[model samples]
Target chain A: MTVIALDVGGTSMKAALVPAPAEPGAGGEDVLASESWPTDRTDPVGGILDFAAHMAARAKALGRPARAAGIAIPGIVDEASGTAVHAANLNWRDVPMLHLAEERLGIPVAVGHDVRTGGLAEAVLGAGRDAGDFVFVAIGTGIAAALILGGGTYPGVSGWSGEVGHIVVRPGGEDCACGNRGCLETYASAASIARRYTALAAVPAGHSTPNGSVNVRAEDVIARAGTDETAARVWSEALDCLADSLAATTLLLDPGLFVLGGGLAQAGPALLEPLEARLAERLLFRPAPPLAVTRLGDRAAVHGAAILASRLL
Target chain B: MTVIALDVGGTSMKAALVPAPAEPGAGGEDVLASESWPTDRTDPVGGILDFAAHMAARAKALGRPARAAGIAIPGIVDEASGTAVHAANLNWRDVPMLHLAEERLGIPVAVGHDVRTGGLAEAVLGAGRDAGDFVFVAIGTGIAAALILGGGTYPGVSGWSGEVGHIVVRPGGEDCACGNRGCLETYASAASIARRYTALAAVPAGHSTPNGSVNVRAEDVIARAGTDETAARVWSEALDCLADSLAATTLLLDPGLFVLGGGLAQAGPALLEPLEARLAERLLFRPAPPLAVTRLGDRAAVHGAAILASRLL
Candidate 1:
């Protein structure tokens, strides 16, 4: 069976014609065709519909016409209604994605939360495959987690289950974009790390590398942590915040494992080792769950979208 | 059909001969016989087994013999194995509760975690019946929560979920019995509130109630909060810690409701009103779930145990 999978993010979209597994509960898949494009910020919904139509056309051209389509989008998604309730980055609110996609592509459509879709891929076929219950935490521009229990993402009361970023690790410490104080994201997100490092470095009290700019990325700050005092402080605080939140998660959920993904997870050992140690330190009783880097990387969401589409079929 | 249900705590036990629901998915139950006793701290397992046997005998005498039994126990429980992994207060370790109960009562047995069991009762037949996904938080000697999703308790990977007391709300604030600093339980648990108030009042600070002793209870501290400055401060800190933990829970789980139970919950409006306000204040973006007192009160666990026994039948 063939399906159209689209992972629509703030800046880019991963569109694919995926040959879904022929048998039930199958593991592997073959991508029939794939492409990427910058998200049309001004006409986001139109862009998504056009992309689905294009993917359907491509699938037909390959003589493997798509049976269903799946689109993984960011924000507060009402999956039951197939509506993108809100996506701050995309300036989207209540876009009837499933209806629009079905109208355009002439196939059953499934819409999923982006992070949760990524987590679905990880839970079924990636790092969390062996971990019975796990949390897939994506640390990109912002932090979010997907609780995968019994091999599926747990959408809490609403679709807002894993808003781990807003968990107050350091109450009344730092101002967050969410209008909260000292959220985990304020210290640990990729954007926050770079922003914090730059702000700290720009201050006159810094001893070395005082020249700060918005161009500085989390990777740069992580790389400079070895000697630069400001970078070290920022990175350390980020690790602490992440540890605090993860510790709370461990206490509440007690998942079998924690799978870290997204831009910051690229640090690999540098991120995992200290995080493991800090989480252990924070937890006085019970062994800490093992931490692992994402196995599927950025392609997770697209694959998960394919899985969602396959489920519809 | 009838079942034997027992809720064994550190200090007390609630035992009952409960009639199994006449129909599946029934709302109410009739207690054929009910009784309570001080827990046999020296021989907790023996006490539990004996209690089950007595309950079974009583059911038989009443011409409604119990076909199954359920025991709700504190501390770590391996429900799958029917073993009480460890109950600190009971000094129990790997006691084969189900096996012992079955041998003693000659019936199928079900073992469950105390807090989770209470949450089950709330989810199916009590306060959380209307709330789809809610966290049942019991703030007695210590704080713990049960995440009820789809009208059942969500047991994490190893059944060690809902250890919310250990969540660090104040990073370096107060020392907890779990050997952690700034845990939510340090400020919010019933025992902690009294302990904190006593400790704060003991020091030679200017206050009306400077004479501190172990005799003071959480209720006394809460009652005095209106007049006593130290009591007010202690109560405020407790509320703050609870609010912080609840905020994190809201972000992580986004439950439909929060069902508060145990000793502290007895404070009623004084606790609920301020807690609701603090939780609202802490959350910047999303709306906080409504907080309600447990309708089953102290009987939630016993009722839940009955539910478990009915499942066995």
Candidate 2:
């Protein structure tokens, strides 16, 4: 079956006319046609409607009927209402995403929270395939988790579930964009680690960046962490914060398996080993579950969108 | 139809033969025969066997047959195996509860974790009836929570879902019997509150106990919180710890309502109002869910057991 799957990220959109609804465990989808577009800072809904129409027309040209379209976007989403409740990246609010796409492309549509869509892909086809119940935590510029129960995302009462980044890991530590102090994102998010590293590096060498810009990305800091003391401290603190939140998550949901995705998850052993050790020290009577990295990486979201589109079948 | 139901606690067991498969909103059970007994710390499984037999015999004498039985117990339980897995209070390790009860009573048996059972009752028939997804936190001698999803207990993976009390709230504050330092139970449980109040009151002014035995209870400290600085601090800290833990839970589960039960929940407004306020301040973009004290009280578990028994029909 052919369907359209779009993962609308902060800076770019992963758009594809993908083959889906094949055997569940069958490897990857055949992307009949795919495109990446710089996300419009304005009119996020219009951008999607236009892209979806284009994909459907392209599919028809290839003698494939677009059965349905599935879209994933950043921020709070109410899938039941098919509304993008709020998205900082796209600068949209309550945009009727499903209706807009269906009206434009003349096909059924599915929309969901981005991270949860990613988690769905991971739970069914990627790292969490063995975890009937698991947590897929994505630690990119922000941190959010998808509670995968029976290989599906658990949409909360209003679809605002999996806001793990805002969890107050540190009671009175750093200010977060979410208007809270000590949110997990403030300490452990890729964006936060880079900022922390920049501030720490600034003190010892007095502006490590000759260009007077904070050029320290999380990947850059992670690269230097093994060799530099400041980077090590910054990296360790991020792991501690991540582990603390994961411990709390393990105690509550007890999914028993954790799939790490997003940008920081690329750190691999540097993040996983300490995180596992820290989680083990706190689990008490409960046994520690294994942690695995995402097999689909950034494409997890697109694959999850394909899965959502398949549900229309 | 009638079925046997039992809620086995550390101190006591509430047993009853309740009517089965009635209308959804009906209140209370017929209680064909009900009994309470001191839980035998030694031979915990044996005690349950005896109780189930007695209840079955009583129901038969009343001209009602018990078709099935449901039991809820404190500690980790593998409901699928009917094993009461490792309860600290009972000093129990892998006690085969279901087969033993069924063998003794000649009925099908269903077993579940206690807090989850109570939460099931609350989610379906009590304060949390309005919530499709809710968190029921019971703060008694020790703390535990039940995650009610889609109006039922979400048994995580190996049935260890909702072990919220050991989430490492204080990091390094006090020692816990769970071999961990600063668990949520160590700081905010009714037992912890009473102990902290007694220790704080026993300072400097010395014979601050006046009664000489330091016999202060959580209720007394809560009652005197307004007038006593030490009591106020103790009460405030408990509320803060509970709020912190609840906040973490909200971040993970995003339940629409929080039903607070157990002994400390009896504090009512003094606990709920402050907890709601604290949770509100920390939740940031996420709306603070209403905090509700459990209406079913301690009877929630027994009622839940009845519900579980009814599932057999």
Candidate 3:
């Protein structure tokens, strides 16, 4: 069995130990002792209980001693009282966090909601495994979603379902550090497309471009938007506010698929071919739901926190 | 046992018979016989198999004969292939409707989707009985929603889950008849607040108002929005486009309640007290879900088609 996962975020955490899935719903696992680090930005729950006591002493030196532990945090989680009610980049709040990760790893923990345990590990082991209802999104440095439905992870009613980057896709434009305004994470977040292409134009905040990169980041403003015109107008207004928040999540959850995942989906195909042609031209009468990418990349919330600690064993 | 139920609606139809819920899940039923009319809208599937063959001859003259039915309809339904695929106000297409209501009421049917079967009779018998995640909406003459969740009726991955009146809350402003522009049913439907207060007031298309009411409906533009000024600027831009589509459905489905059924929720408290204070001033950070209004009003899709024909027995 073995369990212990972690995740955390606002600047890294990961952890691991995994094992579990020998065939229940079977979304496979394995890890058996992984790690990572960096989160402490002022004690992210004591760097997630010191990385769950170093993955419960690396699952007791591989004798499979980890029984249960999940975690997966990041903003406004409440996964049925496991707490961590607000993260705001880990300034956190209400942190019961499954009773502080079961008093720092005594096991039986569970806690989810890091983009719904990375959309339940991309709805069971990556890119909404043949979709039983989709929408995973992520797009890092702020932007969220998860819905996943039948394959699990709805989370609404107080656990605050998905928060698709604070919805209002430009309704008075800009200003949202969640205090809201044009929020689609204030023009599509990968830190708002490298801060709206470094506040419009002459790059220079460690600028280098022409693909040699330097810092301009949202994958260097999508690899200098093919010969930069202010990085193709801030990556085409961040794919037009992520195609108006996926055309309001395809008219409020018609999800069949839309996986995506963090760190601006590593700008693959410059972010899914202009976000699948601007979410199929803002879904005129509905039909746009095929946008994959994220087959466990960024280890999908530490393999959905080891499938929520193997469903608490 | 008895079942039947119907709904239909492009213009009307209600039907009924009901009974079936003495205990299991207990959301009570008991109708026995009922009716309503007006929707032959160009043979809406032969007026729903002649109103399910006159409600199966009034449930065999009230001796309680109905075995199973359900129906519901309205636009784009596929409810797991009960199929009435498109309704565009009953100019239907791809009809199947539970195989023509089990070949005209010979029994077991079930098709749904009229706003998720009035959000499953407001998540089981009205105003979302104690919320299992809410959001029913309805808002007649166009405007939809319904996504109950845990208590059922999510219908996403296809039956186009809750098209919150085509989301784009004023992204391009006005227009919409689904050709989209600023949807939220082009400024909150109830026929878009009496067609935007009769295209910005002169009101004389049978105008009366001052509560003396006559034609300008939407509850006479909310009883002339307390002394007109173009009915308080089209009912405060239809309560700020239904509070920006319920603050983008409270940040993408944090729904725990928001009931408000059709016919502009009969403008009760002038549409739920300024739409619960403009959905609590456009949810500047959550908490806003309590809206309420539909305690089986407009018979919540004929009692959610008698709880989807008592779950087909």
Candidate 4:
């Protein structure tokens, strides 16, 4: 089966022509032709549809003859209804994305939350293969998660499920973009850590470190862990916050495995080792599950979209 | 067809002979026989077996020829393995509950977590009949929850799921019996509310009320909400904490309804109304599900056990 897959991101959109059954591991051979495009968020809805049409057209030009297309977007999406309910970053609400794409591309379209689509990919063809129950937590600019249970990605009834980022971790420690105080995202997310380190660098000498001295991004802070005291402190606190939230999730869900994804997961052992140790400490009697970085990396959503599209075909 | 149902609690045990195909929404009728006994915590493993034997003897004496037995118990129980993994309150670990019951009763036995079994009763026969996805949250001395998805209770992989009370809501607020700081149980449980109120009463002149001196239990706190400022403050905070956790749950697993049970749920509209409003505020764009009190009250677990027993028969 051949299908067109489009993964919409904040800065870029990836499009792919994939053939199934996709290979069952990282760096597999099932993926055929793939390409990328810069995403323009000026007119987010138009940008999304145009990108989908462009991907479909490219596949057609290549004689792939794609029967269906899948688009994965970042935000709350109602997969059952084929609607993008809300995307704060994209400034979209209630966009009938599937219907629009179907009309323009003249093919069946499967619309899904980006993280859920990525999780679907992992569950079916990557790290979570053969696992009946698992949580796919993607840590990017902000944190979110997808739950795969009994062979499907469970989109909570309201299409707002898997927003693990907003779970309160500190209660009253820091204000979040969500208007809540001390949400998990305010501490553990890449964006949050960067913001925290930047703020700390601004403090006057003899007191706390000044935010101006840091001028470091999330990756820069992560790189300085061994040499920079400030970076190590910020990173340590971030890990602690994440471990706290994951422990809470473990207590409630008792998932067999946790597949970590998104940009921050590239830190690999730096992120996993301490997280595993801390989760073990916090859990009362439940055994902690194995935690691993997603095998698909940045392409997970596109791969997952391909899987969904193939199913439609 | 008739079967035996046993509900084991920390302090007492209740057993009933239930007719098969139990009536919907009401406690089953034609209870051929019923018995009660004190739950002996010392040597809890032996006590559980003894309790099952007593119920079996009573059933046999009634001459109903009960065909199967269902038992429900608190704590982390592995229903599939018929073992009570851990019950901190009961001080039992890996108790082979099913084998003991089967040996004593000489009948097929079904075992399950108490709250989850109660949720099964509601999902199949009570207030949750219409909800495809819902959570059954029972707030007693400690709080726990059961997830009902796709017409069944999700026991999770390790059978240690649904420990919702341990989800960190206060982060670093109060010490929990689980040795964690600021678990949700520290603020929203029936025990916590009473404790908070008692702490307020211990304060000196600063605690004196405009109307009169006040001392309140959890039940009294509910009653004094309209007139007493202290009671209202504590009650409202409890409601807020509950809403925060429920909102997080919704974000992760968007259930269609929340069925509240146990002692605290007796507060009814006072709890439901505020919880609904607060949850709505936390939700970004999705619609909030209806919140209702469980119709079965304290008897839900026993009824659920009866349903499971009937299935076995």
Candidate 5:
């Protein structure tokens, strides 16, 4: 059975015509066709639905005859009611994406939180397949995670579970976009790392880079880690912040594995090694689970959406 | 349709011959008979078995003939294997408690983590009855909690899911008995509250209490909250620590309610009101869940154990 999977990301929406019920350990290679389009943040709701319609039409032209569709979006999603309660980045609130997609695509739509869907992909077919319990943390412009237990997504009663980014790691350190003081995202996120490094470069010190810039991207800081002392300090602190939150999450969930995904995960061992060491040092009796970059990488959400859609078949 | 419920605590063991499947809203009248005995911590394994046998024999002698027995113990238990992996407080390791109890009492045994069982009781019959997702945080000499999701205990892979006490709240604060630094227990537990208050009292003038005791108990400090400035300061700080951890848990789990139990819960609104306020302050977009004291109180574990036993029948 074929199902259409749409991963509605912050800047782009990727659509894939995928086989249903992902084969065990198949890594979602059964895609008949796939495409991508810019996500119109100006009118996020209409743009997403329009994108879904476009994908549906494309699948029809290819004669794939998709039976169902799964749309994975960032933010707080009420899966039970199929509503996107809040997506700060997209500025969406209570948008009935499932109902809208079904109306346009003429197929059942399964809606899920983006991070959770990515986590489902990992839990079912990626690095976390062997883990009965695990946390999937995606560190991009922001940090968020999904808790997979008993082989399924644990959507809290209100569909607001796994909002780990808002957890306060530093009580009064920095003001977060979430209107909170010192959230983990203000420190560990890819965006935060770059922002911190940029600020540090402004300091009048011997460690400051000669060509100081007001703004720097996370990749730039990571690229300069070995040679640039200021960048290294900022990068290490970011890892420390991430480890702190991960340790707290480990203490509560006691999961068997942690699957790291999103943009920062691309840093590979540069991110994982130090994180593992710091986490181990902080943990008491509980053993630290292996930390691995997501095997599916940026497409984990797409794979998860496909899996959810396949369930409709 | 009667079952035996046994709660094996650190200092004492309590047992109750409960009418099978205590109905929601059931009263104390459903508990036909109850007994208690000091627990032998030195030989915890043998002592627990002996206590179970004695309770079963007494219940049988009373003509109840319990259909099943449920035992709740404080430790890391592998419910699937019916083994107590470890209990630092009880000094038990790899104890096949369910099997031993079954052999000694001639009844099938259902074993579980004590705090988790208490959470089950609260989730099904007490303060959290209406909540589909909630946390049962029992702050006593040590801090521990039980996660109730979808109306059941969220026992992690090895039955060690709700070990929130070890979550690093202070990062690099005090050393915990669990061999970790800055654990929540080191700052927020009932024992920690007293310890903090006592440590504060040890300082020279202005900080010293009139009574001048270097070792004040949690109860004593709580009693002095309204009258003594030092006690109030310590109590407020403890509340802040608890609030920080609860906020972290809420962000991660998004539970609908928080059922406070154990010894510190006896403080009632004194604990709930401030905690609620602090949690609200910390949260971003999510609304704070209602925080209520556990209605089952100390008997929550026994009631929960009885419920588990009834499930076997």
Candidate 6:
């Protein structure tokens, strides 16, 4: 059997045609075909339909027609109902994702929340493969987490679990887009870190420290944190907020391991060392879980989508 | 076969003999014998051994030979190792409870953490019996929660998953015993509520609202919340903090039901009504999980110990 997987993001979609596992307990299927498309932004649903149809056609031409497909997308998704409740960035709501995909491609389609799909992938094949229970946190433009239990995603009753970014780590510190004050995302997200750093330090015109930034990126700030005073303060604050949030996450779930994904994790030891120290110090009694960087990187969700599609077989 | 159950606490110990089910898939085990003894604060370990010996003898005298036993205690416990890691109130550390109990009682003894056991009871037979994926929080002197996953306790890798009390509801608000500021316990636990109210309110010359206290108890403060200004402020603050913590809990775990246990839950609607309201108000997009009061009350842990003993069968 063949399956098609699509990871729909805010800017683009990564779609792949992967053959289902040949045997019940075998290794992964080889990617029979794959493609990437810029999301319509104005008409994401239509773009998804067109791309999926094209993938199905390509799979058929390659003599490996996909029997089913799975999609992972941003925003509130009702996986059980296969509906996209809302996608603020896409300006879409109540788009029956499963129906539209199945109708367009003539195959069963599974829809899942993006972070959760990434979490599932990590739990089964990435950083948390050996860990019993773990929280997979992605800290990029935003910070969110997926609680992986028994080697699968434990999406909440209302399917709103893992909104760690919105949790009030700072209480009344700063205004959050969610109408809250001092949320973890407001202080710790890569975007927030860059924004805060930009507000504090003026980037020199000749500044060049690897990954060039138009202004000053989170990476640029973190790179200069060792020597620059302003960068040090901003970077330290972000780490403190992240450590504080992780502390709360530990207290609530007591996950065996915390798998840090997304762009911020690229800082590697710089992020992990301080975070590990803060979490261990804060959690005085029990041992803090090991924090690891994601191995699958950005492709984690796409692989997870294929895994989800394979389950449909 | 018969099994002994013991719930060791800071103030007292509740012990009982739970008979093995006569037939498979039965409702519950019959209580063959029961007893309670005031715990010796100075010699908690000795008190526990004496109480367990007495309970085992009582069970044997009643024509029921005990084959196994289960003990629950207040502290940082490693259930797998049968070790009570730490109990500050009891001034104990690294006590190999399982080994000592088996040596003295001549039976297989299962040692479980007190709050986790209470959460087990609530999940299997009390307020949380019907709720799916619930969190059982005991709000006495300090607040702690247990994640009841798949009808069992989700003890973390190091057996310390449910320390929700330490989650900072207000950063830098009040110093917590765990060396943190603005922990959930500092604002929402029964002890905290009463302490804060005492500092803020003047009790009436003649005031009695069940659970009696000379100055003011949590119950008294809650009882006067509707009429007294100071009581109202304190009560509201506590509820708000609780609401905030629960919101974070909901976001992280997405529990179907929240089983509120411990002393303050005795306030019933006074606590639940405001909490439910606040949680619902704060969670604008998602529906709030129903918060229910624990039915077994103080006996919840003892019953859980009995249940654990039965599992030994």
Per-prediction TM-score: 0.95, 0.95, 0.37, 0.91, 0.94, 0.90
Q: RMSD for all candidates, in order, please.
A: 2.9, 2.6, 18.7, 4.0, 3.1, 3.9
Error of 6 at A15 (Å): 1.6
Model 1 per-residue lDDT at B201: 77
Residue A267, candidate 2: Cα error in Å is 1.9
Error of 1 at B253 (Å): 1.1
DockQ for all models: 0.85, 0.76, 0.31, 0.64, 0.72, 0.63
Better of 3 and 5 by TM-score: 5
Worst 10 residues of 4 chain B by lDDT: B202-211
TM-score of chain B of each: 0.94, 0.94, 0.35, 0.92, 0.93, 0.92
Pairs in clash, predicted candidate 3: none
> Which of candidates 3 and 4 reaches a greater lDDT?
4
Candidate 6 C-alpha lDDT tens digits along A193-256: 8888776676554464334656677898899898988889989989888888888888888788
In the range B1-313, model 5's lDDT, one tens digit per residue, is 7888889963589989988776575452278888888888678778777877777777779888888999998889898768898888777789898899888888788998999999999988889987778999999988889999878898876677788888877767788898877788888788888878777866442344567654567878888999988889989878888999898998888888899999999999888888899888888688888899999889999999998888888
Give the per-residue lDDT of model 6 (tens digit) for B40-73: 8888888898899888888788888888888998
Q: What is the per-residue lDDT of model 1 for residues B1-313, given as tens digits with 9 covering 90 to 100?
A: 8888899963599988887851226634567789998898788888888888888888889999989888999998888989999877888788888888888877899999999999998887888887788999999999999999877788788888999999999989878888989999989999898888878878322334534443788998999999999999999999999999999999998899999998888899999999999999998778899999998888889999999989886
The lDDT per prediction is 0.88, 0.83, 0.79, 0.82, 0.84, 0.83
Judged by DockQ relative to the true structure, which candidate is superior, 5 or 6? 5
Q: Which is the leading candidate under lDDT?
A: 1
Model 5, residue A304: C-alpha shift (Å): 1.4
Top candidate, metric DockQ: 1
Candidate 6, superposed: residue stretches over 4 Å from native: A22-33, A198-216, A224-230, B19-33, B199-215, B226-230
lDDT of 5 by residue, A1-313 (tens): 6788989964588889887776474546578888888888699878888877777777788876788999999888988668998887898788888888889888899998999999999988888887888999999988889999888988776777788888887777799988987788998888888778767777433344566643567887898999999889989888888898888887787788899999999999989999999999877687787898999899999999999888887
In model 2, the clashing pairs are none
Fnat computed for model 5: 0.75
lDDT of 4 by residue, B1-313 (tens): 6788888853588878887756564445446777777787677667767877776676678776778888899888889878888887898878888988888778899998999998988887778987889999999888989999888899989887778888878766789988888888999898889788767755433355545645445887788889877778988989988997887778778789999998998989989998999999877556777899998787788888898887774
* TM-score for candidate 5: 0.94
